[model samples]
Target: MSNLIHFKRDELSFQPYSGQPPERASICRLIGPDASSSMGAGLACFDGCSIEWTVLYDELIVVLEGHFRLRVGERVIEATPGDVIWVPERTPLAYEGDQARVFYALYSVDWQARNA
Candidate 1:
């Protein structure tokens, strides 16, 4: 790629996610490998936030607004603003919050694959 891509808040596009995510969810597309593949920013309801487990290939979650309880395998991670959580491949992870929380993440895989 051309030294990757640069995106300003205003230069980004805001779009809602599909799936059963909270209605409060907002995402900004920063980089997309193609029209069907992407990596972006997301904000969702923490309380109503789905505790749906995810098996990440290589992912990192950085809290920006609030705190949440994170479950990864036998370990529980208490994450708050400024806290960064890293989940490696094959690890089942889930997040819980009393209310909605905002977060930034670096997703290096194809979220469309829906790996179990």
Candidate 2:
């Protein structure tokens, strides 16, 4: 018996991000607390949008398509396909993109509950 999970991008069902306009962003969570207590992973898509956020867990984001940008205060980080960005916990940042897709993995699958 094997306990392995596999997901295809085309088969992912994305939901509108609650904090953003539905037309601007969507997210598909691939792994969470139910799967792993220490880590979480997901895919996000953005269409000419920007999202302000404060991370509760350390995260690594890999750009899959189009252009992606991260604004941490006065510093701006830009990424294209095959690029990776690391964000530490407690960082206040803005995610910006123009038709971009990214894969992200974060420490602490239950960050929301823990932070709350």
Candidate 3:
């Protein structure tokens, strides 16, 4: 891998997340085990969709545009541009947004290994 990788959002291929409700939710993997050994990074966008997930790894999310909301257990938190949220492993979270673009990084080398 190169020391630096450049990406133009419009040029990246984003796939609809099959695990989530297919209501304009898409993700593009920017870095993973294929790119790095320490962590994985990605960009995700959602609109008018609420989805639940059981996080298997520590994750840091930064809102890039619009409002993004997350229901972590009993706590509800809203994040906007420049806002950052950290979610621990083994947490159950519900996410929803009107229109949001987020950049996320997971502190795990292999999420499937821990999840499975």
**How many clashes does each candidate structure show, in the order listed?**
2, 0, 0
Question: Where does model 1 exceed 4 Å of error?
Answer: 1-29, 35-45, 99-107, 111-116
In candidate 1, list every pair of residues with a backbone clash: 46-100, 47-99
Looking at model 1, which ten-residue stretch has the lowest summed lDDT? 35-44
Residues 1-116 of candidate 3: C-alpha lDDT, one tens digit per residue:
56888989679888887476555688889998887888999988888887789888899999999899999878899888999999998889987776898999998968887667
Q: Which one is best on TM-score?
A: 2
**Candidate 3: where is the Cα deviation over 4 Å?**
19-23
Which scores better on lDDT, 2 or 3? 2
Distance from true location, Cα of 75 in model 1, Å: 2.7
| Tens digit of per-residue lDDT, candidate 1, span 22-108 | 453445554444632445444444654546566455666677775677786777788777777777766777666655355555455
lDDT of 3: 0.85
The digit string of per-residue lDDT tens for model 2 on 6-110 reads 897579998887577766898999999999878999999888888899999999999999999999999999899999999999999998888999999999889
RMSD of 2: 1.3
RMSD of each: 4.3, 1.3, 1.8
User: Model 1, 1: alpha-carbon shift in Å?
Assistant: 9.3
Off by over 4 Å in 2: none
